[model samples]
Target: MEFPPLPLFTEVELKSEIARVATFKKVPKGETLIRQGQYLKVLPIVVSGAIRVFQTFEDREILLYYVRANETCIMSLTACLFNNESASYAITDAPTQVLYIPSDYITDWQTRYPSWNKFILAAYRNRYDELLHEFTDAVFKKMDERVLDYLRNYRDTHSVHTIPISHQALALELGTTRVVISRILKSFELEGLIGLHRGSITLKKPF
Candidate 1:
């Protein structure tokens, strides 16, 4: 079995153990990795591509964060640590390859492997900062500003000016209605900020 180049797994013993037990998978875009209220049996680490973590309340879903290459979800780590059901679901944001380590191994490796402990602590810190930023933005920023920031950040992350997403999908991520997102996007188009194409939005030249 081939393993992705992960810095944390550089130790010979840990790498060998991971290779012996951990399972690897290539997940297609939009596929569900974890579901809310489900007990996690494995902790997923992204090898390539991205996973979008979100929470659903009633009919709406709010984006929590994205787990990119070489990263693991802190929520998943917490679930593994406490042996609790997941509060949010995760879905592949793009075609993704992931390494899934069994929950039992997670706690066992913490004291056994120094690198593993360091990785877990770093993941926790990074995710906490992200969650704080998300809360701050939701509380202080206007919806339009949030939308624009999302677009710019997405463009920068993906290195694509044309974002292939529907207004409804965008609204779900921003915790708003499709109509509101459409209205805001339309206003952006009118202001020469973006170009609205069929099922996609393209950032303008100066953007």
Candidate 2:
């Protein structure tokens, strides 16, 4: 399938330039798009599916945010603009198609193209809000509450009640141990809030 066009830059010249230089690729689930400590050479825009961005410390990983269709990774944009190594890594959460714009033109376009500048600033603002919300949740919410929120968010994002994910994978994303997540999931199942399967969990009621 042809890569979906980004509605970011409205200027005919800017849009044409992007289409001329940007490359698209399809990646399977679990494919790493960016690695921590590596300098970014391109800024990726998600055309479809999702990419999970996260940081890892001492073998434990915590999710920063997800890049869904029509969205780009602000962290990648920052690294590309500043010529710095990435602080976090990104992996495809599902089969995904991404449009990669070479880093060479990012900063130049900011000053040369008004629409590009606006798009970049807007991306930054959106990502900042998401990060702030994540920080607040981490500071104020209990583990069980956080898990419930994660499940609910996933359900809403994917438009599905049944989430096909492993407990271990969920724990990694939540920055917790699998045992703890399993216990909490079991409790949720007992409470009739969810139904836990061997490799997935189904939401039974709206929360």
Best by TM-score: 1
Name the lDDT of candidate 2.
0.89
Candidate 2, TM-score vs. the true structure? 0.91
Off by over 4 Å in 2: 1-3
Worst 10 residues of 2 by lDDT: 1-10
Tens-place lDDT per residue, model 2, 75-176, is 899899899999999999899999999999988999999988887888889899988988898899999999989999998888899999899999987878
Q: For residues 1-207, could you state the per-residue lDDT of candidate 1 as single tens digits?
A: 566666766688998899889999999999999999989989999999999999988867878889998899988888888989998899999999999999999878988999888888889898989889989998999999999999999999888999998999999888889999999999999999999988899999887
| Runs in model 1 lying further than 4 Å from the true structure | none
Clashes of each: 0, 0
Q: Give the TM-score of candidate 1.
A: 0.93
lDDT of 2 at 167: 97
Provide the overall lDDT of each model, using Cα atoms, as 2-decimal numbers.
0.91, 0.89
TM values, all candidates = 0.93, 0.91
